[model samples]
Target chain A: MARNLLRAAAALTVATLVGCAAPSLQVAEMGSFHVGGRTVTLSGLPAKELVFTPGAPPLKLDPNGDFEVEALYARYTRLSNPKAKFPLLLWHGGGLAGTTFETKPDGQPGWENFFLRAGYDVYVSDAVERGRASWARYPEIFKSEPFFRPKKEAWELFRIGDTDSYATDPARRRALPGTQFPVAAFDQFATQAIPRWGTNDAATQAAYDAYVDKVCPCVIVVHSQGGNFAFNSALKYPQKVKALVAVETSGSPNPDTYDFSRVKGVPMLWVWGDNLGKFAFWERIAAQQEKFRNSLVRAGGKGERIVLPEIGISGNSHMLMMDRNSDQIAALIDQWLARQGLRN
Target chain B: MARNLLRAAAALTVATLVGCAAPSLQVAEMGSFHVGGRTVTLSGLPAKELVFTPGAPPLKLDPNGDFEVEALYARYTRLSNPKAKFPLLLWHGGGLAGTTFETKPDGQPGWENFFLRAGYDVYVSDAVERGRASWARYPEIFKSEPFFRPKKEAWELFRIGDTDSYATDPARRRALPGTQFPVAAFDQFATQAIPRWGTNDAATQAAYDAYVDKVCPCVIVVHSQGGNFAFNSALKYPQKVKALVAVETSGSPNPDTYDFSRVKGVPMLWVWGDNLGKFAFWERIAAQQEKFRNSLVRAGGKGERIVLPEIGISGNSHMLMMDRNSDQIAALIDQWLARQGLRN
Candidate 1:
């Protein structure tokens, strides 16, 4: 069946990406967030459940897996505005957490503050590891899609062997001791911590679900790595999603690589550089069904793509959004979003 | 109309970029190129007659003009195996440029070479000035789509406004006073020329057409800006396009901002970041559109967004694909593509 499928499509796939996807489980949960500055705290917040902490809101998750769930909301200043849509969950990239959309670098303008000032409600969260959180979990590289199958057949499709296990191998343990720390850290980050912080986290998922059920998000704005989490969560609870704006993709490989790709018709943007974009090396994996590329074509989402060399951003770092000329990035995105016909 | 259109997509997608009928266009031009160390002589290159030379490739409107074109192709080599299905121009990002598929760093495997070693024809060329040349006649931004009403609309979509004006901007006045230079040369390359280029130009178009006509490009591996060009270009020639792998998108906004629901179809990977994918910045623009975030929800595409806190691509510039760590990037693209089942 696989060979035949390839012969039929690869022979003439004016629009099909080769070899990608597998059905998996779709998990959903929710949690409450401590909303920050915004107008109409009630409206800006996604339509979900928010339970105020009886006393002090616990920072750490319950060790025994018992944790109270609540919905996060914004104390937006412009609640009176009837035209205001429900505030959204504005997530930033990694590094320092907390600086909501309301505040930006050097007080120039924050995504939160700008929206709030414009009569829009927003909930911002920093993608911080939250203390020893980054290291606590025993992250494993669980294959959402089986990576260890008939290698020869799938090898041409561009699958990786047990690449990261180099450090753990007993034979090479002495030769590559330094590789152990970062790889283990990465594994944990990808497996345990990510699911927890992302929509997959049982408590956080519950809280997010509660919020979504309450306010009914008008849109979700995510940047960098947070963009993936936000979108992944939305996929888990697609019915609760309205729209998304992914700033700079970090990991948007194949949909089947994950477990879900259904929606009640949501709008999204996959931002990238000029000509082509590869989230962590598209050249490596783009051969398989070319997930985002092939699927969109098959689905018939004839949208426009923007590829620029660098909108005046020249730096040597992982953060392109925060480049020296970030204004260009910001202004371009704003102008484009404004063009999207989205309401404030 | 422009306002309404922008309102629809949430971003100004001036598009339908393409070349016009010109008798000067010819077939099968050949040339030799030495880039990133490898030197190969291309034979029977398509659109050879359009090579930008003194007079061989004449301009569309100007008889005594100079113009040239380059073909574009990309393929990934298995980091584990050099000999594999080296499909050329078979991968790409949706909204970014075409070159985003391969790494831009030297001593690194060019995706095209990867395929070449893997036994596939690789055709790549430079994109600049105009489809038909005499760089003077061609503006920095060319019509990457088909000829449409309101030429500005297409330009707006691609976000290359004031092309005629920018061409005359005195900022980068060539050398001394008054003398002018092509806008592509202004980059602080620290030298008179730069080797890294775009997946555009006549040569690329011809190559794309040829690939479409023959193998049917099952996977379109695009990153960053190439997404825009690839999406629109594929739109113009849908028969030639199979599937789309639009990595971090920057061009797509809401074709209509108010209508957050209607999106063109194509399976998509909406990768997002902490902020907007920095493309270009200009006056009157602020705020970043979570492009990948928003795009995932576009009307039709089935999208899986992956957000990572850190790409761990050290010393790598976002103008990646050519920057350092391209192998890692390629590995990821290859992995994604493999999942899609387009190994060949």
Candidate 2:
């Protein structure tokens, strides 16, 4: 009787402590691409990829921000590549969102044409505010996220973009309530969308489970703070993505400085602007770049900080979100992929 | 060396699983009210006394479903008993939201008149919609709360108005966004709002703490399904709210009935309606009421199932939220309050 009582007490103790384990997530794969100079071959498209279905409604941009626009990519609808070494997932930088990977620069075909042509099946989405999804969709998508506060305490306040990140037009800001808090939007993306899109969200989860179930060696090439999206998503869903290329982007404040207790691993590439600090204004990100990289490294991630030297013009790294330095960045990514034995 | 390793392992395990013990909620008393035959009071008010601040923007209800009225006692800036009971934070029923407590019964005042005249401060907010704040300011009032699903799932699907309850909503036949598998909105409420309004929400934790730093006998009165809100909020911030009055409500579906869980400890009251249902509706509630009451009883909380038949009217309980029956219900509440030994 005494032994039985002790066993029952022990069992009750464990149940109270663990309650239930966070469920394991099974990630989906959207196949890989090959990067040959400029012409890209596209492969294995996960039918449910976050793209406008061909002949589907054109992606609507929040009317408030001049930064947003969605053009239905007719070709993306039929693109598919199976049995590739790695699938390409397009990630956007903070303050800017959308599938359109065009950076702010002259003579660049935006990363959209860059990756799509490189034969890599790329998937892109405006995390909440910046891109195409209606702003009204927010309160639901970020259902369980807490208001990230003491943000002044937990994180180094400003992220990829700050005061300058706001839309100039009052109408645009009106269109997106998310504008009220841009950084909160990013945190929601990493903590909410990552688990949900591929696994947690019921609607998206089923699509993921049916298509990309655990197959890895995928690449997350993110622009800006979308760097966190790629890294956190991969970290939280490691089995789904392997190598990552953060194109002209700095590391997110999650892995090292913030309470990302909700997110956890994945190898990463820290492709930051070589002249991130050149900007007279929001040059603070450059200061934290080293700490960001070191944190990811400390947390069992393979991260490299890439700050491209001068884009065609002498400017700051912030412009990289819309910069025209794809060919150079693409090559660097190609090199990274080659080393990872990832296709294309 | 082996003992040290074992000790380190045990400590790590405890730290990871247990998390910090939820801080004890320091509940204090504010003021009281003798109403509807019962006397009730506020708990966890910021000043250890019933504090009322005036001068809020007036309420607006031009919407087709809601009637227009000045909620501020003929639009008087604002008034508080100062020594009155804790404010009754009212939330709208599921589909209908904040409109649930509006007292527009053709002539007499709504919740505003009933409570204000009675000397208790009332906070009726449109927990789901944003624009309503100027007039109704209910809800997350958390770091950022969201009492109901963002777009009013409860109102559209489970709405129990003067005529309908979740039981009667034809839409209930179809699965709602968050309800497809039958999880209670209560869980979603706690998961989201607690982070914002309760001590859990990082943004508002300090505010919630500071606000409730003094004494409170805070009494939360939730009508209909808002009971879920009252119950969950009290569970998460028990120190902030001392007593919970679930007027005309039963807890949401629990794990024993479905796959959901029940909240622990808050006292509850389930007032039945005579104006509702064909005799069958009340019978259904009667049938379900026992199980609901039994569940709370087993959880170590006191509860009661009051029927309108107990009063002179056959079923006046359903009229409790309106202007007509407010006084009677108020009297009964006064009686219950006196029993608490809480006096103003």
Residue by residue across B219-286, what tens digits does model 1's lDDT show? 45555544545555555555455445554454543344423232244444543322222234412121
Of the candidates shown, which would achieve the greatest TM-score relative to the real structure? 2
Write candidate 2's Cα lDDT for A3-92 as tens digits.
Answer: 433443454344333223312111111111111011111223222211222344543221111111111101110123322366565655
Lowest-lDDT window of 10 residues in candidate 2 chain A? A65-74
Angstrom error of the Cα, residue A312, model 2: value is: 8.8
Residue B320, candidate 1: Cα error in Å is: 54
lDDT of 1 by residue, A1-344 (tens): 34433432332232111111111111111111221111111112122222222343423211221111122322222223423444556655532223323222222333443343334455543232221111111111111110111111111111111223222232332212211112221211111111112212333334444445555555676655455556566666676666666655444534656433364355566544321231234344223323554464455542233333443222212222322233344344444455556554
**Model 1: what is its DockQ?**
0.01
Clashes of each: 247, 82
> What TM-score goes with each of the models?
0.29, 0.31
